[model samples]
Target: MTERSNQSVRRAFKLVDELAENGPRGVSELADQLDMPVSTVHDYLQALIATGYVTKDESAYKTTTRFLEVGHRQCHRLEVFKAVRDELETVAEETGEHATLLIEEDDQAVIVAVQEGPDAINLFAYPGARMPLHATAPGKAMLAHMPTERVTDIIDRHGLVEVTPQTVTDPDVLFDQLEDVRSQGYAIDVGERIAGMVCIAAPILDKNDRIRGAICVCGPRSRLDEDRRSEIADVAQRAANVTQVNLDYV
Candidate 1:
């Protein structure tokens, strides 16, 4: 595509996202927020309305139910079971801690599934939660399996910003930790993302050996002491392996 075409597409995406976030905006409002001319936004809105992705109501434009359908379809397309929720539930039961499944989406680690553990300790992760790839256990689990170049690119783009005092802020230290994760077949975050919380995660791989996502068990550091780390790690690995086997990716 030409530079102009690419810029137009990017503008359209920004407008749609603004509509989704602000809900039902007029062409002038969208143009003002996007810093584009009203004429350009109107043209894009007309095209989107014609495509049935955006709907016109009186003088305002809002995302149609099509976006909801698209989101559902995207969530359902995961190779995991149609009953993937059950996987987290079982993991929570087995591990007695919060069980979460996070996937790499749009170059970020997104929590796709979550189950409250038996301990009832509140954790921050939930479905739709997004975290940086350099700070969290699930993120590191996925990052370790990616190529070194891709890892460096992501770190360069996102930077190893410290989310907490324990978060790895140095790229070199994070790379060394990734090597350790690769060797151990799992990753750990001890207050790296959230203080006082510890997470153990393992990568979920597809049959073709692609790193599909990650499964994690999270809880207080007190409970996940040296003695229980192996136990939690074993459960996380088992859950990931089972999830990969059962994933029916279309």
Candidate 2:
């Protein structure tokens, strides 16, 4: 591509990202936030509107449900997601908590599906949400099953940023915890990502024993004590095993 066309593509995606992240915005507001000229921003907005990816109301421009359509289609296309969708709901229903299926992407955990039970607490989590691998149970569960060299590369790239006061910042400490997770067949999180939240997760492997993703059950700390944690761990592990078995046919 020509340099000019490459720059245009980057700028267009930047505008779309800005709208996706911050909701509707006026032309001048977008220009100021992006440090681009008003006329340039308006031109980009016009192209986006013409393509049906964005819509204008009064003086403000916002993205349309087209983005949702694209995201939904991409998420549903994953083989692991298809295999684990029912099991994720089963986990939540049986545990009375939030259940999630996540996969690693660019060294971060991407939530592919979420199910809530009758007593589940809303963490405002949704599909396509990304979380740091080191601070989440699902992330750690997957990481524990990964090769040591691969895990080291991910940690080196992401640098284990502490998400909460309870987050493990030391690399050595995290390595030790991962060792425990590998042997136990599950991983636990106690306020590591969000304060007062607890989680249990297990890695899901394919027929060849390759890591595909992870399944997790999460809730408030008050509700998941020692006994409850052990129980939920068992539930999560079973769900993960079922998902792995289902993948064998897929």
Q: How high is each candidate's TM-score?
A: 0.76, 0.96
lDDT of 1 by residue, 1-250 (tens): 9999999889889988899878999988888898999998999999998989999999999999887677668777776534356677888998888888888987798988778877848775656778898899989999999999999889778788888999999888999999999999999999998899999999988887788889888888888898798998998888787777776543
- What is the alpha-carbon lDDT of model 2 when measured against the actual structure? 0.93
CA-RMSD of model 1: 3.6
**lDDT for 110 (candidate 1):** 93
What tens digits encode model 2's per-residue C-alpha lDDT throughout 1-250? Answer: 9999999999999999999899999999999999999999999999999999999999899999998888799888988988998888889899999999999988889998999998999898998899999999999998998899999998888798989999999999999999999999999999999999998999999988889999989999999999999999999999999999898877
How high is the lDDT of residue 77 in model 1? 73
Most TM-score-accurate candidate: 2
Backbone clash tally for model 1?
3
Off by over 4 Å in 2: none
**TM-score of model 1 (CA atoms):** 0.76
Maximum-lDDT candidate: 2
As a TM-score, model 2 comes out at: 0.96
